[model samples]
Target: MATPGVFLISAFVFAFAAANIGGALSYTRPPPRQTLSVPLADDLDSNSPQQVHVSLVGEDKMRISWITEDRAPAIVEYGTSPGVYGSSAMGNTSSYKFITYKSGKIHDVVIGPLNPNTVYYYRCSLDSSRAFSFKTPPAQLPIKFAITADLGQSGWTNSTLQHIAASNYDVLLLPGDLSYADLLQPQWDSFGRLLEPLASQRPWMVTQGNHEIEKIPVIHPHAFTSYNARWHMPFEESVSDSNLYYSFDVASVHVVMLGSYTDFDPQSAQYAWLQADLGKVNRSRTPWLVVLIHAPWYNSNTAHQGEAESDNMRKLHGRVDL
Candidate 1:
């Protein structure tokens, strides 16, 4: 016969064993198989100039853009020296820090106040291997320009860019979604290289698109953050301190950019600034007026949902939207 203390100890040991066995059985089940996605770059390319395109800004201004995989600050070198006018335009450099982008900002450097009826030369670089050269539009009056939106770098999209180039427009006004950054970086890199031909020749005036917004935090560096760093737009020329929302005057046009992401009240800073800017514009200098913003005021789809916040803004333009 066992002593009382021994019996108690034996009973405790049995209970512990039972619990352990039960716990083990519960945890042995297999987990679900929903795998995470991986970025799709099996091969890496060298840091070379890609997506080179040109846009006509004004009579004296042009925008040049390119991309590199260097993951470093971008640099540009050119001057009026012999063998150097096609890429000429000594300006401050802009860096690309957004990882969300496979490439960097489109280096929309301005080569402007250029001599009328003159050609210029220039080169773009990352560090070891990002060198590219291109020419400028001939200075002339009644200059022609191409304008559009939703341009991309792949899938026979070259045809669209080719059409723009063939027009030989002095300027290109792209209001939204220049290249789809929402796709992976490779797509953006392709778009970068695709535009080189057009960007090198004319000034491409641009705004932003909904696709440009950054949803992830890690990619903030590349998120339209690169946009701010790369393009030297004359946003400051507008009453607003930001080019993301500002206005500039071309020969006979007053162009304004609105921050469609936020609520816009006539009393808002940008609204007040627009009022002042428009008030100041001499109708004689710029007779035409146009507004550029990402969101549409009204559309039929609504995508068809109802929300008070969206409804308030819809009142500005319309309830239905694009």
Candidate 2:
């Protein structure tokens, strides 16, 4: 006969083992979906703007970003009504080279001390036929944000975009894993063209993910070389030295986007900036504080378990309320 304490210990061990076996048996993953590549418009002229998207600049400004195959002026003309030009803004253009791939001229123009909640028609370069319009976010509360993540170019991505478009959300928050180009540079252009339809009309704020880090050991040693050149976030406006992380405000909400792929150690610039950014936030003005990070601090999924980024970031939870 076993002692009472020994019997209890034996029973506890049995139960724990049974639970682990049960969990493992129940876990199942669905089949992978087919990948789809969205092609560029066949009718677009060489100088015509393609992959046009917009992002919020400061409080009253919007940054219009697009790509052109040939040399095109980085100019944007805009007004409240369609086909009417009341204001114009000039901006800069740049391109990047990845391995043997050379990108088209990328243009970014910041427009307006725009009115909140009002629609503004805009044309890129000198083309009136390619006119696009976007509504600025409201000045007050009750704002809706359509949050999404891991938006690789696929058939599923198309469905997701359609669902988001019908939702009528004010802004879109993407925590990372965009494009999934993974060093195939042309895929980035394809992804941009796919996103232009929705991203053009609304502000899409995003952070960097592991997929964005297309670093090769000898040939291409740099990380985020492609991503930094393409998705230009308002990092400078927030006084952030790197484009990997930044903060922005929409209505009564304050959003901070953190980079999981970047250095997040306590001694790193990202960690230091996060402390200062959170400290500067006025809780009275922006009632809600939302932080976006690529890797989750706590996750039940088996794929990305026990990551250093997640562990290190979780440690800061006690130091900061976030």
Candidate 3:
């Protein structure tokens, strides 16, 4: 016969031994945790025009956006004197912003009055040889430009962009759906790094696309938080900075950027604001009026099949006659 206290102690010792054995076995073989990396890549090759593009941000002003393959300081050398570009030159150093967990820096350089239609030589680089140039289009001239969406593509998609680029144009406007973000962090980083060329040379203006919508997985939150966060668009005060929606004067044209993802319905603040904005366009000063929205209301593409909300807003602004 054993004392109750002694028996209790013996039982406790046995349990402790069993627990230690279990712990040892578990330590020897345990499940692994999956780790992820924020994606960023070597920018486009140093000074090479990876995604060279241009946009007329305003009268006498051309915005150029491009990419480099490396993380280096930016150097844009330009001048009205063609052969004397590097000499008697107007030099402006620029910067590239790499978003959190994303790769590559977004670079912008604005040049102006460009002799209207004269051939102006220019070059852009950072940390090295970003040599490039182009002739600015003449002012008050009817210009042809390419428009597309779902860019920031890889090699295959890049081929498509190249196809579009083959056509000469005064400006390039990308409405949205740039990266085709599929919840992979590295893909996002690579996308930014790759587009440096086009973004740098051209204005490469854009709106938040469907891919810009944030999500935890393939499901559907369809939120624009990620897009809004990464971009430094003027959506508040300076024309188009506060919310990716604003008005700007481009030569004789009045351009309006609308925020379809946000509230643009009659009851929303954006709707009222836009009505007020369009009301004041002063058609006399700006002859041609244009509207840019991520999701166009009337498109044959099934992806935009039922964009009823955007359709409604577009109808409200029928002045464009769509």
Candidate 4:
């Protein structure tokens, strides 16, 4: 025989406790696995294609790049649908030489005249392993892109990938310092595999960073040998002599990716090209001009304090805009 007020209070307390417990049980959890459908290291050690990625070559053309344990022809069979690849294209492959290890075969093929803003499916091999799909950028305004730099292999990198995948961005612009492969070559392969799920699904346009300049002493002191071998950009199409710098346009946005590690003085080739590229930009077509470089011209970081690229660029009519 409890009082009416006591009975009501007791019921209310019970309901509150039950609701909190239910809420706790319903909390969302991240997946136990690292990345979706990521193959084991053993699978990547052979001729199997690893670190497969895509890049936009033109309005109607796309390039697919991958690495293999051995030299193989760059073959890509693509069409508007999966398993129905009525078209096939073959390209070339190249390898990079290090002091100890010779890198696997790097393959690249530019396939073209694809339907705008449509989801296209393709297989990399003549004996295709897994079919991948990518959507061409729409020929209209409001293009969405995700840009980041210095993405070394770590747990944070894993989380970043998961977030990027969920966002469904149209393009990925990595200014520089990708993989942090530095001297250790195996990390490059690992980085590629980790990025496959996201990069394979979108265009990952990149430029060289200081880290990419892995200059080995004694045997091979040359720079960018490994970086140049792995990442093949469409600089040639843009009439640029070096892949170290290039520009591309998507919708109303024109992106200029510069090489901080390369020459940027007034008399340098890059500076001259930059001037010509800027002069040719039609504001009517591309209203927004965006520039990306690994080292910020106006950065306050003490690590790169001695660098005066920002000041030098300004003197040469290269203004930094946020």
Better of 2 and 4 by TM-score: 2
Q: How much is 286 displaced in model 3, in angstroms?
A: 2.6
Q: Tell me the whole-model lDDT of each prediction, alpha carbons only.
A: 0.52, 0.83, 0.52, 0.76
| RMSD from true fold, candidate 4 | 16.3
Error of 2 at 111 (Å): 0.8
Candidate 4 Cα outliers beyond 4 Å, as residue runs: 1-45, 304-322
Relative to the true structure, candidate 2 has a C-alpha RMSD (angstroms) of: 11.3
Q: Which tens-of-lDDT digit does each residue in 1-322 have in candidate 3?
A: 1111100000001111221222222222223333222233355344454444555545565655554445533445666664445522222333322234443444555566566655555665532344555655545536555566666555556675677667765555666676766555455545655565454444455676656665555444446654554443434433433455666654455666666567667897777777777778766666677677776554454543334434444444554464
Where does the lowest 10-residue lDDT sum fall in candidate 3? 6-15
Instruction: Give the C-alpha miss distance for residue 230 in model 3, angstroms.
Output: 6.4
The best candidate in terms of lDDT: 2
RMSD each, Å: 22.6, 11.3, 22.7, 16.3
Q: Output the worst ten-in-a-row residue range by lDDT, candidate 2.
A: 6-15
- Each prediction's TM-score against the native? 0.62, 0.85, 0.60, 0.80
* Residue 128 lDDT in candidate 3: 35
The candidate 1 region of ten consecutive residues with least summed lDDT is: 6-15
Model 3, position 132, has a per-residue lDDT of 53
Please state the error at residue 81 of candidate 4 in Å: 1.1
What is the overall TM-score of model 3 with all chains considered together?
0.60
Best by TM-score: 2
lDDT value for model 2: 0.83
Using lDDT as the measure, name the better of candidate 2 and candidate 4: 2
When 3 and 4 are scored with lDDT, the better candidate is: 4
